[model samples]
Target: MELYFLGTNAGVPSLQRNVTSIALRLLEERRSLWLFDCGEGTQHQILKSPLKLSKLEKVFITHMHGDHVFGLPGLLSSRGAQGVTAPLAIYGPPGIKSFIETSLTISQSRVPYTMDIIEHTGGVIFEDKYFRVEAAGLDHRADSYGYRVVEKDLPGSLDPKRLEAYGLKPGPQYGKLKRGESVELGDGSWIHPADVLLAPKKGRVVTILGDTRPCPGVEVLAKDADVLVHEATFMEDLAELAHEYYHSTAKQAAEAAVRGGVKSLFLTHFSSRYKDVEHLQPLLQEAKEVFEHTRLAEDFGLYPVQRST
Candidate 1:
């Protein structure tokens, strides 16, 4: 899995950065893309990347802020125009359904595919065979949220050497054994999967938070996550201003990452005032002081979330 940062600015767009939108590409796992936040000009940013609109399977909105949702309707309409027939699911806080429906109605937009808009209060919102998503209410001016995406543990692979010991070669029987099934040999003897399978591998965890101040919900959603994408909207010196605006400073975000025990933290949703890399270095440095593995997110940056051994 990989995270594609479509926009990384806070509140509004700037010459260097756009607003907040992130695309989680699950191409290897599921051949789909799951978006977190669709800030204004998000579709425009996607066009600049290698992402395909047709692969967009789900969208998770963090809040109702215009910077986070203004591009959603336009993107949906464009997806319809592109003739993508696959169904899409959207999860967000209450009033999200109304927001999408109202925008589509006012614009007279027609989406050809099935769209499932789920306005969840909190907790587990989605779960399939491969992944599970849980939401936690966050501290913000609006009813914001953070999402924890937990990938299901994968089954162990069949050992080729062990199969060879049983006089088996690569074939459909190996496929069945790999699936944890028992296979009958030509001699009428049965071979169990455990006899040839290796240890199961652990899945990865990714936590993405919307605009918020340092809160318990952040800790809950980010605990032990392989990747924690948190909004660092201000520098350490602006802690008071950040608190007042229901936003987090880089230092605060890194502290939260430490508290959550996340493997790595990616700081995003930067204030537009930091126009250049030189201006933004302090934010990253401050975060690094608290969490050594903290990284500053940039527009169009692709971060790979590798599986845990």
Candidate 2:
């Protein structure tokens, strides 16, 4: 799985960064893309990347703010013109249903595919065989949410040497054993898979926080996560502004990551006051100083989860 940061700016689009949007590319038996937070100008941002609008099977809205969801109607309308006939499911806070209904009604837009808009409260938002997404309310101006996308635990690798010791050759039966199935031989002896297989590898966890301040609920939601994508709308020195705006500062985001025991921290949602992103370097540096693995999220940057770690 990989995260494609299509937009990384806050409030409005800037020359360096657009609004907020992200695509989670999951490669399993099939290729699927999960989108989080379609901010204003999101469709325009997606055009600049390699993502297919048709492959966006699901969308999770963090809040109902204009910067976070103004692009929803436009993107959904454009999906039909781009030959996206697949049904899409949207998950968001309580106001999402009314927001989508009012927007689509005012625009007179009708989609060709089935669309399910779920007004979420809390807990697990969506779950399938490959991945499960859970959500919790965050401390923000509106009814904001934080999402945790967790892949299912993968099967343990089979030990070839141990398989040979059991007089088993590499064949169709070996594949069955790898699936935790027991097979009996003609000699009335049975071989168990648990003896030859290693423990299941825990799945990687990626947590995304909407516009929020440092809160205990966020720390609980992102506990031990592989990647914690937290919004840093201001520098460390702007703590007063952060509190006033109901947003987080770079230092606060890093503190949450450290307290949550996250392996890595990705800081995004930059303020649009600066012309060059170099101005934001010190803010990111402040985060990295606190959490050694913190990194500033750049537009079109792909953050791949390390498997061996």
Name model 1 segments beyond 4 Å from true.
none
Query: Ten consecutive residues with minimal summed lDDT in candidate 1?
Result: 155-164
- Candidate 2 residue pairs in backbone clash: none
Question: What would the C-alpha RMSD of candidate 2 be, to one decimal place?
Answer: 1.6
Question: How does residue 295 of candidate 2 score in lDDT?
Answer: 90
lDDT of 2 by residue, 81-181 (tens): 78778999999998888988888889888778888999987899788886889999899989899999888888789988888888888888788888889
lDDT of 1 by residue, 131-248 (tens): 9999999999999999999999988988888988999988899889888889998888999989999898899999999999988999999999999999999998888999999999
Best candidate according to lDDT: 1
Q: For residue 112, what is the lDDT in candidate 1?
A: 98
For candidate 2, the per-residue lDDT at 264 reads 90
